[model samples]
Target: MTAARDDHTRWEELAAGYALSALEPADEEAFLGHLPGCEVCAELIADAREVMAGLASTAPAVEPPASLRDAIVAAATPRAGLPPSPRQPRRRETRRSRYAAVAVVAAVVLIVVLGVWNVALQLQDRGQEHRLAAAERVMACVEQPGCRAIPLAAAKGGQVPVTALVRGREVSLVADGLPPNDTTGTTYVLWQKTGAADPSPVAAFDVTRDGVAVIDAGRLTDPLGTTEWLAVSHETGREPPAAPSEPVALGTVS
Candidate 1:
């Protein structure tokens, strides 16, 4: 019961900002781990996600500078811990390793969401630069081998580009131009197809506006090469929903 109470308190303090990617890496990961079983947090995340989408519509479109990747890598590289010189007075300090900084931000978006950017800016004003760097690092890793970008589209609806990174059965997916579903009892789900076998639900999520959303990376793990195309479907709340039944968008796994 204490643990549950603690989770609620934490949610009240940071859930919205966490959804906006405003927390430190550790905090963000912790929140994500807590999301699945906590319906309250899930509902809150849905609300925050909608806020993110609305901001996306008003944000500027800018290509990340070529140096951004290098900057991220440089930021993520570890440095040795050196003791203070004998001549200086020493004080205690707590530190975390650099590898911890590069866990991956998980999404690609030419248009940065203003609301999210504002939340990050608030952190910056408070001197939390390292926190915001996580997203940049994730974007940097997207250029690495195994991960590729492709468009997720439908003949009669809106579409977006997804940046996908699959390692063994796990995947890291982030999308640009993602919007949320507001229809009652309905949500968006992700499916992965293998050869001729039916597509299986790999991830499930909903968006409120137009922005970028990173579907649960853990849900992405599937037998590597066997996974063919990826599709998004609208369905009743059941996840991996027996079947997409009706696909909203589909794309080849490149």
Candidate 2:
């Protein structure tokens, strides 16, 4: 009984990581080898998956920059004509190395969320210069081969040239004549609809004094063709709601 309990406990530690696709290769192989007849571990994995599915529905999806893909490829590529090392790093350095790796990973995640201007502000200390550079980047996206420029219509009244540049799953919003966020604390939040699923919140932002705002690069929850349209909602707070309040602007994605 004690041996069985210990075995179940060991598998339980790996269940969540495996479900999250975060387990190391050797551990994953062992877990898969042991899982076929292990009812206890199978039940644990199912519970972890259920929790992950629930969390994914509320979170905004983001696509990492192309530079991240290049970095990963360079790291994974083997050195030419070099023999592989037989020895691993010393155990004493493992914890420090792990922490350093985690910090780099966290910074990469921040880059995806903050976009170019904010990343330059945090890392390079260039504010206005980076904002201009980011705006230029948005303009350049329109020249790209497969980019679609979708114009949004004001829900209340008047004609504003609010455009969304969509290429693949990437999206950049450029807006003019949007009503400025006021003392009432209502901010414009972007949302996307794909097929019959509930509209997913994309980002929350405010416009400038001239009623101009640019979301340099965003990512939709679904693939480009699968997404039906995009909308901007006037949300009460900076924090995104589980569902949008009411749309102030709407655009059909084609």
Candidate 3:
């Protein structure tokens, strides 16, 4: 057949089928010959090839039954004078059927994987929330023992604020409204007042510019006994000074 140059549009339409190996051998060769020099035709061929590749990868291979092969061969063999056996039912398979199966399977797999990932992420988030709530409850119980709340307002235009819960031997310091400390070389420190005696160091903790910092304030068995004061100080390193130069806030536990 004379290949007409004007038939470029018709060929381009068939390019994808040709690239996917769905077209007859002659047509496939014709499209391939025309593809290299034609940008539009090349894009069509590429798109078709990608779809074909995806289908091939996802489709499950089904072996033709031996009986089906035998039937096909018998039907295809020419009989003397008879019209060449009508094209035997395709025993191998057609690209269209294979791709359809692949599409269904791919969709199912994508849904399952996404569903599982979303569930796992949600569970992880819930677990973290539960842990924080438990910690808050513990703080509330500690504060019930006649503990005093000392507000540590922001210093030097810093918005961060801290509140200390002081009980006899145990004092819990809760920080809120405080800008986070500089992580490079700074930490927040807690101190206890011995009244007539000098101030003693309780514990040290790190604070983010936002968020809360909770510190353990020893064990206070007696709720209404002696006087103990709590304070917050900022410093760097592990060992906090026994005496803080300035206290952000002060409160006494009855």
The full ranking of all candidates by TM-score, starting with the best, is 2, 1, 3
Model 1 stretches astray by more than 4 angstroms: 1-138, 155-161
Q: Indicate which candidate wins on TM-score.
A: 2
Would you estimate the TM-scores of all the predictions?
0.41, 0.44, 0.39
What local lDDT does model 1 show for residue 10?
Answer: 50
Clashing pairs in 1: 105-138, 169-221, 169-222, 170-221, 180-207, 180-208
Name the better of 1 and 2 by lDDT: 2
> Candidate 2's error at 94, in angstroms?
90
Residue 88 accuracy (lDDT) in model 3: 28
- TM-score of candidate 2 versus the correct structure, residues matched by position: 0.44
Return the top candidate by lDDT: 2
Q: Comparing 1 and 3 by lDDT, which wins? A: 1
Candidate 1: tens digits of C-alpha lDDT, residues 1-254: 43554346454334544554556667668877777777655655565466546546767434344333333334333346865323321111101111122121113222233445776677555433432343453555566666444455773665554545555566655655545676566677777888888778787777654555565456553675676787777787645567777666777864
Local distance difference test, each candidate = 0.54, 0.64, 0.53
Q: Residue-wise lDDT of candidate 2 within 1-254, one digit each (tens)? A: 44554355445555544654656678789889888987655765665556545544644435445355334223323458898444444442333333333333444444455564455456444444545654675668768898877878887767844678788877888777676776357677889998889999887777744544576547877887887888888888776798987687888877
Error of 1 at 208 (Å): 4.3
Deviation from native of the Cα of residue 84 in model 1, angstroms: 70
**Stretches of model 2 off by over 4 angstroms after superposition:** 1-139
